[model samples]
Target: MALIHCPSCAKRISDKAPFCPHCQFARTDDPESLERAARIRQIKHNQSLMTHSFIALFAFVGGFALWWWGGEAADGWRAPAGIGLMSAGFVGYLITRVRIVLAKRSKG
Candidate 1:
């Protein structure tokens, strides 16, 4: 087997080894393996963004429903609570949008 430098730990390792002995980083010089790893990372990032968007939508809708329904109730706190929930949802959406933009910028 030939010796090569580990990409993660920068240590010498056997080219045939599946992982680095020092840092346990997966060793794959194949173009397909590199592409697959990049794809997986992208998929995971997209999934996270989707989750954040869903949560934001749910919170905003739930808050609006609460505000509408709470109007019939005599509680003075209901309106404020609903507004707070909606604001939180708005903040989450803004955060998600910023993160997506930053990711695209970094990629470019």
Candidate 2:
């Protein structure tokens, strides 16, 4: 069988194959299918970004709140706990930002 390129992923596949082995793109030559595949990928990427963003937001807010509440405590443990929470939140946010930048670079 002759090999053909899978438009969805630009991978080579046997012309007789029912679907692309790598990306699972169907063998159809329809333009809409390719567009649909791209759209699906984009939607998934957006969902991931949203999830990260929410997590980052929650972490930052929670950490700040903890720190604020802990500052009012007479015991020393609360201050340390608050600092740890804030540090964790900062780290999480940094990681998320890095991932976002990397993703954008890869996409470009």
Q: Which structure among the candidates has the greatest lDDT?
A: 1
Give the per-residue lDDT of model 2 (tens digit) for 20-107. Answer: 8998877776888877876777667767976887787777777678767745643466667767777777788788878878877887
Q: Model 2, which residues run further than 4 Å from truth? A: 1-27, 70-77
Clashing pairs in 2: none
TM per candidate comes to: 0.66, 0.60
Clashes of 2: 0
Model 1 Cα shift for residue 79 (angstroms) = 1.8
The digit string of per-residue lDDT tens for model 1 on 1-108 reads 899876665679998999989977797778776666666666678779879988997898877777779356425787888888888988888888788788778767
